[model samples]
Target: NCGTWFLGRLQTERDVARVLDGLEGAASAAGNALDRSEIGTLLAGLRSRVFLMNNAHEEGHLLFHTRWAMSYLRGPLTRKQIKLLSPSAPEASGDAPKPAKSAVPTSKSSRPVVPAGIEEVFFSSEPGTYRPYLAADVTLHYLRASHGLDSWEKHVILAPLEEEAPWASAELLDRGDVDFSDDAPGVAEFVAPPAGSVGTARFRSYGKQIRTHLYQARPMSLWRCKSLKLQSKPGESKSEFASRVQLAAREERDAGVEKLRARFAKRIQSMEERRRRAEARVDREKSQYEQQKLQTGISMGATVLGAIFGRGGFGRATTAARGAGRVAREREDVQRAEEELRDIEEAIQALEIEVEEEARAYLAEREDKAAELEEVVVRPRKSDIAVMGLKLAWKPD
Candidate 1:
């Protein structure tokens, strides 16, 4: 049953997915189109937000499939994996059931088994596309109960199908599980039969086998997340829980990011203001220094010219010529200094204006972010929403 909160929750998920999809598409279109600098910036941002230091493997588990796709596109090797399968593969393959093959053997007898140090996964592909550019077939276990509160334990093994990816070990991607409890209101446990028990593992596999088979046949060029946070209660549907979690995560992440940005922006503005003030002071001092130097030089040159001419070492015409030259030189120096002072003043003004603009923007953004955070953290609780139902009134006729 979709509760009153379902609509908003669903919309939030769709919105997030849409945004991530847009990023992925843009990155894909930039196929071999983005330069190293651009890629590096995107990569750096992703790393700061999604990846841990020195842990490239964590990336697979951290971001959603769509986010991963976008990041991959921004990577230097995006183009190579974009064309995983030839466009002209057979339109459709006739129905052919193949033999059952194990993904990761638990017992491990010379066969490929789930490896160590592998955790988290995200895989995705476009709708109606048989292949997934980002592919990982995982096996997980969980529980579902209807009567009362229940617990869910799940294990998933994710494998990337990309040929170029450094971590393409299918063996390592074969298996994992999660152990969770659902005691919150309107929630229950997700229970299933034990392994090698009655029901088919395929059904128990949560359609993983089918997805894996399809991925092998036709490589998909899409993004997906193999790893998902499954903290949802039994009463709550998977889709609904996924929506809420995504929304919560997005809200939290975005708020933190904005706060960081505002903090840094304010800092930058302060620094810039300080720089402008310093520059202005320097310019003023420089102007004064130049004026004094020029005046002193002029005075000295005049005295020298007077002395040279008064000594009668040269004719009257020569003395007058020397005086004119000295005066002309002093005039040019004064003009040049004035021009430089004007330029410095203009630069200082421009910097001051920029600092003011940045300050305004920073304050607005900070205020908006603070309001948003308050709304999320301090808004009315579910009980309040349920209690404060809308009242419908009609005019008496």
Candidate 2:
């Protein structure tokens, strides 16, 4: 009799009701063959089994096309709808008998209530949970192969849920109880990092939390990509490698700056030496000019006294002319020395300005170089790589 039963797709409540009606009619046709109680029992069993089978089939179908189905559904099926569709769903109506109350006080809070004896788990973001489908393996494999990411043992992908499903909350997709291991054969597990963990900051940066849902999958748009590369040394974690690369870059930048400073310091020192020499020459010339001036004063006085006393007119005249000429020559020498000193000071100032400009240019160059260095050496974390894979999964073949 079970083998004679026809199985057809039951996608809607009307479809299920129609099927039940057909079964009831068939039972009625057996006049006096079956009693009322027997008929009720038979219909109940058939309805229960049929609903169970339908729910299982629908779940499997959703799982196989997890990402696509989520995109289409936009949000999880409402509890009322699920209850109507799933025969095993708990009754919520007042007519249904209430379960026995526990000793714990029940609050009317919006937070989910945990059953007694079960540990309550909290997520930093809402746990947007989804069931893994059969096609997940194939999708991951295709991602790994297409992206040339065979070296990584595992990946965790992050994609923006807001873009694909606007009604869905911004949250990390919850990979419920999925354990990720390096030895595992699949590309990655859909597990969330524990709250307050090292890489959890990366997740929070996106400002999305997962909402509790029966069906979930990675979004199509990639939010971030993380991956590991061939380690420079043995037993290096991705975090450690990133730190090392950053340290090396900082060291390189510092070394370059120091070298530039040292080079400029040498040039400045040479200019300072020239400035000192010029100052010394100016001082020496000043002293010589003063002496020459004093000598000329004394010679002129002597010449005036000699001429006034009529001791020697031509000799006094010659001495006065010589004194005047010597004084003028000393004054010219002092002026040249002072001019040289001014030129040296200006040159030193100019050199200082040049050093500052060059230093600024050098720093800018190092900043650009540091960015390039990060791009070249730094690799993303496992979650980032997983996000990339998720993005790749949605790409057309």
Q: Backbone collision count in every prediction?
A: 38, 14
What is the lDDT of every predicted structure here?
0.35, 0.43
Per-candidate TM vs. native?
0.22, 0.40
Residue 311 local lDDT, model 2: 90
For residues 1-397, could you state the per-residue lDDT of candidate 2 as single tens digits?
3212343334343444465555545545542132323222222222212311112111110101112233355477888998886878565898877785322321222122111221222222223332111111111211232233333323233333214332243233335423332222222223221111112222233223221111133322111112222223333444665566566666766787788779889888988998888889888888988998898888788888888898987787787789889889888988998898899889889988887788788777756554432222223332333222111111111
> What TM-score quantifies how close candidate 2 is to the native fold?
0.40
In candidate 1, where is summed lDDT lowest over 10 consecutive residues? Answer: 387-396
Residue 269 Cα positional deviation in candidate 1, in Å, after optimal superposition: 4.2
lDDT of 2: 0.43
Per-residue CA lDDT of candidate 1, range 127-153, in tens? 221211222333222222321233322
- Scored against the true structure, residue 248 in model 1 reaches a CA lDDT of 59
